[model samples]
Each structure stands twice: as C-alpha cells, then as structure tokens.
Target chain A: MNKLKNTFYPLTAPKLFITDKLMRLLLMGAASTSVLVVCLIFLFLFKEAGPFAFKPGLGKLLDSQWIPVSFQQERFGVGSLLSGSALVTALAMLVTVPISVLVAIYIAEIARPGEREFLKPFIEILASIPSVVLGFFGLLVVAPLVKATFGLSTGLTALTGALLLSLMAIPTIISLSEDALVSVPYALKNASLALGASQLQTIFRVTLPAALPGIVAAVMLGIGRVIGETMAVLMVTGNAAILTASPLSSVRTMTATIAAEMGEVPFGSIHYQALFWIGIILLVITFALNIVAQRVLKKYGMMK
Target chain B: MNNTADKFILLSLRLITYAIVLVVGYILFDIIRNGFSALNWQFVSSFPRRSGAAGGIFPAIVGTFYLVVGTIAVSLPLGVGGAIYLAEYAEQNRFNSLIRLAIITLAGVPSIVFGLFGLGIFVLFFGFGPSILAGSLTLACMVLPTIIVASEESLRAVPKGFRDASLALGATKWEMIRTNVLPYSLSGMITGAILGIGRAAGETAPILLTVAAFYLPRLPKSVFDQVMALPYHLYILATQHPEAERIRHMQYGTALILLLLVLGLSLGAILLRTHSRKKFRW
Candidate 1:
C-alpha cells in the first residue's frame, strides 16, 4: 500500500492540478447548468400561473371551456389537455410495445444468422431518422391515407398522432428489450431446450420470464418517448385542444398545447404560467416513468 | 404437440420480421422518390418564399449549416471535456454518482422542455430574442449528454496497457491522456459529433421557440438575425399553409434535403463505428 501510494503521489503533484479538482469543477458546472435551466423554467412558469390560480377564473382547470377572448369571461381548462396527451400516448404504447417485443424476440432467438445481419442495422437506421422528418411524412403520407380511408377530409387527428408516435417509440422498445433479451444467459435457453421444452414454450416460459424486467424497462422507456413527443404530435394531431375519445377526432396533447400556444401567449400571464404547469406535468410524468423503469429493472436483476 | 404447428409458428415469425423490414424499406424508398427527386439546383441555391411557383430553400440550407456549426462548436468541447473529467479524474463516489444521475435525467428531459427553458432564458431573459445564437445554444445543451456518454465509452475502451506504459515513461496524468488516450479515442469522438449533428439537424421545437423566423431573411448577416431552418420551414409549410401549391412543393423539397442530410450523417457514423470496432477488434 505504501509503495503504491509512493508511485502515485508526486513531489510537486503538477501544481496546475488537472485531476481531482478540475473534475469537480467541470461536473459541478455541467450538473448545475442543467438543473438551473430546468429550475428557472419552473420558477418562471409558476410565477405566471399564480394569477390564474388566485383569480378564480371563469372555469376550473377540469372544466371544458377554454375561451380566453372575452375580458369579462376568461376560462381555461387543462383536463382535456391531460387526457388528450394520455390517450394518444397510451394508444402509441399499445401499438409500439407488441411490435417491438416481437422484433426483439425475432432478433434474439428466431432470426437466422444471415437475416439478423441484414435486419439489425436496418432497425438502427430507422431509429436515427429525425422527429421533424417523421412528422412531415406523417402529414403528407400517413395522414392523407388515414383521411382517405376513414372518410375524413384531412389527415391530422389523434390516430395520426398515435401512429407517428408509435413509430418513434418502436426503436427505443426494440433496442432496450433486445439488450435485455440478449442478457438472458444462453445456458438458460440451452437448458430449457435440453429438457425437451419446445422453442416457443422455452421462450415464453424461460427466456421471456427471465427477460421480463428488461421488457418492462423497454415499455417504460417507450412510454417516456410517447408521453414527451411534441413536434410530430403537434403537426399531426390537428391542434384542436378538445376532449375526445374518438381516434379520428382532432385533438391537442399537453405537449402540443405548450408548443403551439407559447409563441402567441403573452409572457407572465395566467395562460403562460398554465403552459409551464403543463411542462411541469410532463417532467413529472416522464420522471416517474423513468423511476418505475429503474425499479422494474432492479427487481428483475437487470443492472442500471 | 404438432410438428406442423411448430414449423408454421417459426415461419410466421420469419415472415413478420421480413414484413417489418419491407415496410421500413418502402418508407425510405418513398422518401427518396417523392422527397429526394424534387431536389434541384434552383432549389438548392435560391432563397425561400418566391410566393407562387418560385420558392426554394437556399436560406434554410444555410440556416441549417450555421445552426449545426454553432451547435457542434459549443457542444463538442463541453461534452468531451465533461466526459474526460468523469472518466479520468473523478473518484467513484456519491457526488460523481449524483452527476451521472443528473446526466441521465438531462438525457430524459424532452426536447420541448429544453425549448421552454431556452425560450425563458436565452430568448426572453437575455434578450437574444429568438436568434440563431439562442437556438444553437439550446441545441448545444440538448446534445451535450449524448456527446459525454459516447466519448466516455470511447475513453473507457482504451486498453489499460496504454495508460500503464505512459505512467512508466514518467508522463504526467494529463500528458498521458492528451497524447495517447485522446488519439486512440479520436474515431469514437468523431462518431459522437456526427450523431450529435444528426440529432441537432432534426430538432424542431427549440428552433421553433428560438430562431425559426416565419419569413426568410433574404439571408442572415449575423448570428443574431432570425432565419428559417429546414425543419422549421417544413413545419410551417406543412401546418400553416398547404394551400399554396408552390409552398407545398418547397415543403417536399425541403423535407427531402433534411432527410438526406440526417440519414447520410447517421449512416456515416454507423459505418465509422463499425469500421473502428473491426479495426480494433473491439
């Protein structure tokens, strides 16, 4: 121990010390900078939202009215905002998770060697495409197709947003679940097969069970992506800011509401603060999902 | 219980996987056919908003380039510097762990949140007023986590022998990293930059809040001048006025160009990463 210390410890120790102290400074700067930015946003948002909270607006936040035009009758509700975001995200995850899991299964077990080679990188390429471009494609291609088939005049709707978001979430689900699936020991699979368990049975009972933690993690990650998606949802979801269960109806998600309105909403007003509150909601939801993901992974013996 | 059923299930799995591949391929092909073939010299060189049939994306392209350059300039140093500090200097402790958690949290923070933050701080507070600088700085913060993670992986990939040999040669810790560690890790560092650029190019929200001028500024003379980016231009053209035939065409043309840029960069990074892994047998 003494000899090792002598080797590392130096006479002058490079007085312009670049190691320990420099690292602390750099980390502190990066961490504080990130936290500070988010904190400031919340602070500013609440400052603006206070007036709306105290003034007793025309309607409660859960009330359906959103007319802010009349000076004597101002009303804003975020219930639809929350529901619209939730409904779209839920639909997206529903579509994305199964498809992603199947792909993960195929890659992890079913694909022939040559097929795996071709398919893996192709999926990666799909993932690397940008969200804006995805939104554009949804607008021009997917939206029009839906409108034509569904007897709608235009493409922008909850269904369009859900479809686009599903595409966005697939890569995350597939990738993380693939990691989890692969982490299932080969010995386990071999043992199951050796016991005369059919391939499908082995996968469902052993491989998948062993990989359940990872699968859950992937689902949570996809939830994060779907819930937080903005531009594509904004462009394709018709921005109607209404409550509807019908997938074809034009609606606005919480994310879309913030993005579409922030440009026109006067700063430091009730509406502006409400948008920040929406942001706060978004941050909380995603953060909770991430924590849940961590917990699920931990329970399943999956390492962080 | 039945061999036929087992074979059918296996075959169906294969078929489903193939279907996924074909769908993705068709999407790419359609993008190329509809979006790519529209690219022209006039489209590449002319400024935006010719009103009727003469719209082009010269300024949007320039705006993209400027945003990318500025973002890279800001993010690369800070990200790689932070990564080096984490990997090289920081001891495995609570504080370091907390910072790691912060980075992971930062990574999870949505792009729109980053946009809101950017809007509040850079645009409104500092009075940068939704300029390119604000857009670029916001993007810089957004991509920083990616760069840090990628570079840290690269730094970790360096063989321990290299470090031991440098130490035996009486080299200081900084000298060891500067001369040997960095050179060996340059390929990975470059790969991270490429990935970061691809991401920044596709980002729409931050640009929407920050720069994304509704009308093209004939051309930007300085960083402060508001100008349209390709994604922003595409958003406007897609959402606000699809009625304009010329603007509609410009949207497809712009989308094609932006897709090409992002796809090309992503492919290049993947290739570089693959090649490096092969070269190093990593």
Candidate 2:
C-alpha cells in the first residue's frame, strides 16, 4: 500500500507532497498547548499559595486546631483532613484490592470464556456510574444500614465513605489487574501446571509474580482515585473536619476540605492559600504514584 | 483436604462477587423506593422548600440541564478538533508522546484542584463569580481529556484508505477531513460528546466552587443567577439539616433523582458503545 501510494504520488523531492516541517509543526503546536495549560495551572496555584509556603506550617499542619478566623490568627489545621482522607482511602483499599485481585484472577485464569464475557461488562457498568450518584446512594442506603447495624448516631461516617469508595475503586483495580494477569504469557502458567502445581499455586507462584508490576500500577490507580475523589467523600464523610481514628466517627478529607471551604474562603487569603496547599499536597502524592505506575508499566511493557 | 479448601475458596469468591452485585441492586432499589413514590409532575415541576419535602427539584433539574448543555458547548469543539489534529496530522514521536502524557496527567489531576482553579481563574479573574458560566467552563476543562481520547481512538480507527482516496480525488486536507473522515466518524464523536456530558452532569467539585448555591429554591432566571445542583443540594440536605425526618426524605429523593440522571446518561453511552461494537464487528 505504501509503495503503491508513493508510485502514484511520484515524489521527486523531500517537500514534493507531504512535508515533515508541516506535520512536526502541527504536532509540536498541539503538544505545546497541553504543556502550556499544565504550566499555567501550576503557576496559578503556586502564585496564589506563595504566602502560605512561608507561614511556618509544621505546627499548623500537625495540630488539631483548624480555626482560620481571619488573616490575624490564620491557624489552619489540615492534619485531621489529611489523616481522615488517608484512613478512609486506606480502609477502602484494604477492602477493594484483595477482592479486585481475586476477581481478576478468577476471570483471567479460572473462569471459562463465557463467564468472563458475562462478568466483564457487569464490572464496566459499575465503573460507568458517576461518583456523585454513588455518594447519593451511600448517603441514602449504606449510611442508614451502617447506622442501624452499628448503632451510630447519624448515617454519615468514615465507614460509609470507605464502603462507597471501595465499590468505586474495585472496578479500576479489577480491570487493570485483569489486563495484567491476562497479559502474562500462557507458557509460564502451563509449565507450572505441567510440573504438578495446582491452579491457585500456579497463579500465586508464577502468573501473579509475572504480572506484579502491572498489578502495582492497578493498585496505584486505585489509590490515585481514592485520594482525588471529592463528591462522594463530601457527601458521606460527615464533613466535620475532625481528627479521629474510629471508622464510625464523622470526619472530613483533604478533597472534602477544599470542596467545603472553597465557596466560603475569602479570595487570595491564607485560608484560600491553605486550600491550594492541599492541592499541592494532593498533586505531589498522586504525581509520585503516577510516575511510579509509569515506570512499572514501562517495565511490564518491556517484559511483554 | 486441599480439594475441599479449594472448593471453599472458590465458593467464597463467587459469594463475594454475588454480594457486590446485590449491593448495586440494593442501592438502585432504595433510590426507587423513595424517589418513585414522590416522583410526580408536581414534584418535578414545583420548587423545593422547608415545609414541602416533595415540592420539586425544579431548580436542580434545570441547573443540571444548563450544566450539561454548557459543558457540551465548551468541550465538544475543542476535544473533537484536538483529537482530529492528533490522530490525522501528528506522527508517533516525542511530540505526540508528550501530548499523550499531558492527557493522562490531566485525567489524574484531582477535581478539587480544578475547583480551586475555577475559584481562582473563572470566578476571581474573569469575574464570572459564582455563576453558571464559571461552573460550565470548569466542567468543560474536566471532561476535555475524556472527549479527546475517545474521539482520537475512533478517528484513529478510521482506515487510512479513506484519507488516501479523498486526497487522490484532488481534495485538500481540510476538505478530506470535513467530508470523508468526519461523516464516517460522526457516531464516534457524538458518543464521546455524550460521555463528556454524562461526566459533567454529575460533577460536584467545580460547581461547588463556581456556582452550587446552598438554597436557590427558585429556578435560575439566567446564566448569571445562582443555582442549586442536585449533588450540592444532596450534600447540604445530608450534612447541614438539624432534623432527621427532613434528612430522610431529602436524602432518598435526592439520591433517586441523581441516580436516574447519571444512570440515564451512562446507560445511553453503554448502549451506543455496545451497538457500535456490534455494528463494527465483522
């Protein structure tokens, strides 16, 4: 096809038909625009948050007192929000990751073709539902159920948020982990089975280890999602911004803090900058995980 | 012993999978139980208030519609155009690779960060303070990457022969794009736009910063007027309310409506995707 096209066009010189300069320029221009958007966002966030960088925030960040009354006494405590987010996300991941990996293993290695076909789309539907809707469901149904079972005061708690988040994260973990497990070459699993290894043993010893990097990427993506989630956490987290280790206690998250405070915060103030600082924290955490995931993916890609 | 243990493990996994499915079903059923009972024309049309729990979601419904429309208006052109340029013109090199990386990065950026960006740029700098325009623009940016990637994949799927044939017939690059490629790829582009709309409709963060009035019982008079979105309303009614009875009704009704809107949009996309997959399958 390439030869036929060249013969027909009869290119006599470098610039005869399609020029490299035009293609490269267009590609470069498009790439530059995206980078520009990213740069502009970072610059805007940092410029707004410059003052808070100098505000000596070890005490403020560490302390539980999050009272930002005015510019005079602007002591914002993000410890609770950070810990709350981490707790909820950790709980959710604890529940989701194992179940997701199990399902991935089931579908990829154990399930017959028909079952895999049937179950995969069902999981995808779960992913397609928006987060806000999930929050609403949690608030209405899961929260009440938790309250009744656990004898809690209100329906909203870290437990409810974690439950909903687990559901949301499962799809990510399952899909990606399944892709990883599926991509592991058949020969390794076959050899393990031929050598008298049980199917589960084969998966654990050979296939799982081979797919370890991709599985890590999948779990990181799940963590990235939990950290960034806003609406669901805001709805079900009780939004109290209190520091608590108890899953039953009503607490707020870093993302929830921004959502709750952004509307009320005075423009270009320390309180506002504090929110940007949260954004900075979130960016750093997720960006680091993303880079790690990228390296893992690259390693796995090279393996394949 | 090993066989029995294996059987038990498989049984437990199957049970857990079934339980997850049941959870999803339970959520939908709960929503329906509350929402369906109150979902009359009066509830749909009238304004919500303290006394009238089932009065209406008039403002919220309208607000959501405006949000979807505004987001589509802002994101569709840019997303589709960028996808076209990327798929058609760009070579697979460092430049295109950078573009891909930017898109993945954009997707991972927290929605809360976008909310902050909206607060700083749209509400503060542009002075579209706490209005629909600000909310919509923020959502537009949020959905842009999804649209770009979806449309790009579809465009890339278009065979190279079509482009070659159009060029052979003395068609300019722009003409070929306008006529040959676009016609074939219209369904894919529309699907992407619809998926973008679905995402924008359910977004709470950007709107939380941009618009998302706590009250606003009345329907928005225009884009300038403050409005209460369904998700924001649910958030308020869930957390802020002092009364438990009020909370119950509000929570259930809001949950149902939100689920309907989100599921409606998402199911539409899934159906389209499934249909397209079937149609395209040889």
- The model with the greatest TM-score is 1
What C-alpha RMSD does candidate 1 show over the true interface residues after superposing them? 2.5
- The worst-scoring run of ten residues by lDDT in candidate 1 chain A lies at A30-39
Which digits, one per residue and each the tens of the lDDT, describe model 1 over residues A98-143? 8888888989888878878888888777777778878888887899
Query: Which residue pairs collide, candidate 1?
Result: none
The most accurate candidate by DockQ is: 1
TM-score of 1: 0.92
Report the lDDT tens digits of candidate 2 across residue range B141-237.
7888888888888887778889999999977676677788887777788888887787778777778888888777877777877788887777666
**Interface root-mean-square deviation, candidate 2:** 3.3
Local lDDT at A43 for model 1: 70
Please give the distance, in angstroms, between residue B167's alpha carbon in candidate 1 and its true position after superposition: 2.8
For model 2, how does the per-residue alpha-carbon lDDT over A1-304 read when each residue is reduced to its tens digit? 9987887666543443354346445544644555566665677778777787677654566667566675566668778888899999998998999899988888888778997887887776677676877887787678999999999889799989999999899988998999999998889999999999987789889999999889999999889988999989888988887878999999889998888777777788778888888888887787678767877898769222
- What TM-score does candidate 2 get on C-alpha atoms? 0.88
The lDDT for every candidate, in the order shown, is 0.80, 0.79
